[model samples]
Target: MSTKYQLFIEECQELLAELESALLELEIEPGNIDGVHRVFRSLHTIKGSAAMLGLEDVRELTNDLESLFDRVRSREIACNPKLVTLSFRYKDMLTEYLQDPEKGLPQDKTTQILMDLEQVLDAPVHAASRPVESACEDCGSCRPENDKDADILLRLYHLRYHPANKSFDSLDPMDFLSQMQQLGPCEIHASPELVPPLDSLEPSRCVTSWDVILQTGADEETIRDVFLFLDDPGDVSQFREINVDEAAKLRQAQAAQLSGLLAATNRPVAPLPADEDDDLELPEPTESSSAPSSSQPGSPAAVSSIRAPSSPAPPQAASQEASEAEPRKAPPAGGVKAEEIASIRVSATKLDDMVDLVGQLVIVQARLKQIESELHNPLLTSVSEEIERLSGDLRERTLSLRMLPIGSTFNRFRRLVRDLSSELNKEIELKTNGAETELDKTVIEKLSDPLVHILRNSIDHGVESAEIRRAQGKPAKGTITLSAMQSAGQVRIVIKDDGGGIDPDKIFAKAVERGLARADSRPPDRDVLQLIFAPGFSTAEKVTAVSGRGVGMDVVKRSLESLKGTVEIDSRPGQGTTINIGLPLTLAIIEGLLVTLGEEYYVIPLSDVLECVEIQRGDDEPERIAKAYDVRGELLPCLVLRNWYHMGSTGPEIEQVVVVQAGNRRVGLVVDSIVGQLQTVIKGLGRVFNGMRGLSGATIMGNGALALILDVASLVTELEQREVAGTGRNKRSDRSH
Candidate 1:
């Protein structure tokens, strides 16, 4: 696809998201005129853009929806649930068309929706029933039917637009003119005199200025809104209603008089290229214009009215006239200047590439430090320290560029909740908070499916039926809250539901039935609940279309692990369930505690490290050291790396215990010696090492050796499971006695 078309698709996706969200909100609060306007504006923009891209079918479908909402905005029709549903269907169909225009619109469905929209529009308005406070305060036309209404008189408007140079990237200026033409009888004049010669002309730029005289019943704001997307529309465009007396003289004015008047108010333009003749012939202006006509000069709708020829006035004289006429054109009353574009769309691939480059720089900086330490040269040490400081700053800023507010991702679940709740014959509302919490772009992209699956599971499994909830003294409408906040260097996202929580006894029974646990096992409720994430594990008796195949939670587990994140669950049988997921801020580089184990080095993520302390280990029976260790008072589980990995070498007399928190548990990781802390650039293992247990990924050491990054959470879990199994066997032996 062309770049422009790709951008158009991206823009449509964003607008569609906004449209769906607004429609959902409107369904909840029908009296919200702000929501009505949001829906209308999104549709209007999509329709205009579709028209610019020559997608007539898309334009037609979107225009119908836009008009429907416009009526809602004007208080001519009430906003209802049925209208929101219809708008959602339109939004979906528009998305499909934009993705593959060749397939065209589904005729039967499109016709049905249009017919429904017509029925809604034709319905009688109940002005007395509407909430008067909900009426749009600033909208002049947004009045109830019983209000004292004045007849809208046709007024002539003179508009001269010199579109901002940057506007052509997204909006076509000609489309604005066509929209005005749709308003009423309009005469369009194009000034080609400003166009530079062939060598200097930009094919994509809108250089030619336009002067239009339109007669319509539309208000001044309506006319001015055509150029609303332009930053500082008043700076480049002029729109004023002509006086009744001047309207008569304007029609009778000669070409010379009209040309002089335009020259006095128009901004100066780039002169023609040097090689071009000064007497180039100019195209004649059209006397009448209409929408959907040929864009070229002399087309059927391009009739002449007022023409500005190639021969121009002296710059000095034109400047004086422009200055004198500028004061007469006052800013519109109560007009707020449009803010400039604040952000631009960037390609994900480019951002990923930039991150990779930054990661490589971090590795090289580490190598420099290694050299400086060995040589101990004053000059080299100074240079290395400076490079280290600069690289650290650069790494932080570069990584932050990929951080995006998770709110957009959170908003997506609203539609899912609405649809699924209806499908399940329940009333469930999805609430979100701390959506402004940010995460790396890559993390967010991969995080989407896991979150969706969790939400679906929450709706299908966690939430009880509305009848059941009411019987239990809970509200009939269940609520699922998705909230996120940054903690330490990790973002903690909690998805909580106010529905029937999981029963640990049921989960334990299912685990035993599936041979995932011993029948004699009696673990803690938290441990049993964690079994729900095991592959092919399910507590459901029968499979349903939504879930019960026991696939989603496992996938959520695997995906989170791939991002070096952890997940935990908490629940009360009679209360509700809350799933907490913790993910690092960035996956590229992290601060790690480097240590050695029998000649091998490993990096443990510092975010999880609570503290490091010395522990005594014996040369013989080193494996016995993999037991509980006392930290101040509480005993924490400890895992000796040399024994866990089954290395040939034995442990030293003294060992370092790195206490790290994984999920809700803190464990001690024993190593031969501590290498201090350093920034470790994470590198993924190849497919050969994929799914390897205990190690999440590999990183490069300052001395150019590869150190496996320990998956502390997984390691801690494995140790706990081993200890539990050993206890189970001992209990069975006691029963035999």
Candidate 2:
């Protein structure tokens, strides 16, 4: 119902995930004190939060778990496999409790686990068997057994209500007072002697502190039940029983103190304005120091009040005020709350909007600089240069705001690895490195699905069985290592596994069966390995829910391509497999090289461009060209950009070529000119241009011109496809068949 409650629910779910992970780890290492403490803290926090929300069953369930961990902490009991299993069951119970708080706690499974827990808890304790009379004598406070209920006390209760958040938007203090009135005779008072002038008052703020004396037959517990949702136990609020006579005297003292406090601070005013109502009253100083003249001083007509439940004794804070009116005591140890962490929760949409706005500013800055250089005025140029520097700095800082460590994404896989390995009957270990490396939040969110596919493939297909690994002179447990590092302006993630690797023959056969590979073709080993990424192709003997779907590896390739990234895999028949993926740091903006092909502009990401060099080609016709170029002494494969785009034009005698590397291959891109580098804001080419390849996105330049951004990774893949198409199965048919 309240935003704070909603926030609590969201956070609770996240904490539960971490809690489950910790318990599973603890199950493996029973002596881990840190793990036990982590579980205890999570459960304790959940219990207190549930108590404040008045979710009784959820609170009780968490309390039980916290108590179990407390025993583990005290060395009274060790963490066992059975207890960890029960803890997981309890975790699920908490989830169902959140969904259906009204339904009674499900008793069937909980009862058995609880009973087993009791037996386990009692196993180590050897209490002496003693007679009933002796047991009674050991505890004098314990009364003799009686069926009749103990007499209810008429003692007074002192209650102080403090809300978790003091803002009026979160809670109402008067509504709490009304609930107290429903219990018994209650009189509440507030201290408002220094009320700011009416015009200066903030209507949304809460300034009044409550002091109340509730005269009721209800014991302290019943009285406390009224403020259950208002405060956590022993905090922000205090409820304790006091002597009835003392409560009466205290209320009288509070009234006297309030009157005295008001008379001391009140000052008489002259008159009211014409628009002011004549009946509106203001406090006037009274002659007597102990009592007020007619009306209570701070009791304004607009304040929320309850009718006196009985002989009106001023509320608890009044009594406290009376005591304070005498002397102040030293503060208690926990009188102040710990300072809140310095962070803000912002939605992803907000960050995207900020980047978009910053991108616009950058484009305008470039436009201004272009105009200034054309005019060649000293003063105008100076201003433009300053604007350019500031905009660049602002762009960097804005993009950094979207950068988050990749560790959170990596940590989520730990649980997946633990669960899936158990289900598949495999002994596997996952190790991660460079988790602290940072990337754009949007890019990281898109990475989860692809990483899952890659990791699952490594587990289900690449990893060999324990028996097979041991027989092959490998360790019984297979290891999957996921490491990431920053390279140039990209983040490179490599997932390597120590398991049985891909077999080229099987991959080629599977591709041929799926009509992807020619029946008689005999490609190189490396080329055959690439067939795993082809759509509708798998080497599985049978289909299952997880792997034989045949669509996973293709999905990984497509998702990575959408982010302007590249994925390459290497495998040996028995040495295991490794997959390397490279992605741009951020998709919001990139430093790009602007080039022209047939008067149409294009942007190639500057990160991928190694250098620009002039190329010498003898022929002008596209059909007469060779696919390789000699740069200095090294020969590199070339992609003729002008011919590829069907511009129907020839390049000059000496053309500029941008040498870019994709994976292990280098390709020369021929363009008319290299137009330096600047930051480009990437905009998507919508569904109408979806079929286009090698072009990832579009951007606007300073001269009101549009440039299509080139995707080097996909371009190289396209080149590979063309090469394969040209050398058809017919060329190699004799070698295989």
Best by lDDT: 1
Clashing pairs for predicted structure model 2, backbone only: 211-315, 211-316, 211-317, 212-315, 212-316
User: lDDT score of model 1?
Assistant: 0.75
Instruction: Please report the TM-score between candidate 2 and the true structure.
Output: 0.72
**Candidate 1 per-residue lDDT over residues 1-737, each given as its tens digit:** 66556766887888899998898899899887679767876887677666656778778978888887777766777888888888888878877877776687889889988899888889788585443564344233343344533223345566676663554666467666787776676666565556677799887877777766676666554555555444335534556555322322332232333455556669444433334432212123223333212232322222223323344555455545444433354444223333434566788888888888988888999999999999999999999999999999998898889999999999988999998989999889999999999999889999999998899999998898989998999999999999999987789999999888999999999899888888776888988999999999877778998888999999999899888889999998878999999999988889999998877789999999999999777454545525777778989788877766666576777879999888778889888899989898888888877757788788887788989898888888777876776631111111110
Q: Rate the local accuracy (lDDT) of all candidates.
A: 0.75, 0.71
Question: Which candidate leads in TM-score?
Answer: 1
Clashes of each: 5, 5
Evaluate residue 697 in candidate 2 and report its C-alpha lDDT on the 0 to 100 scale.
Answer: 91
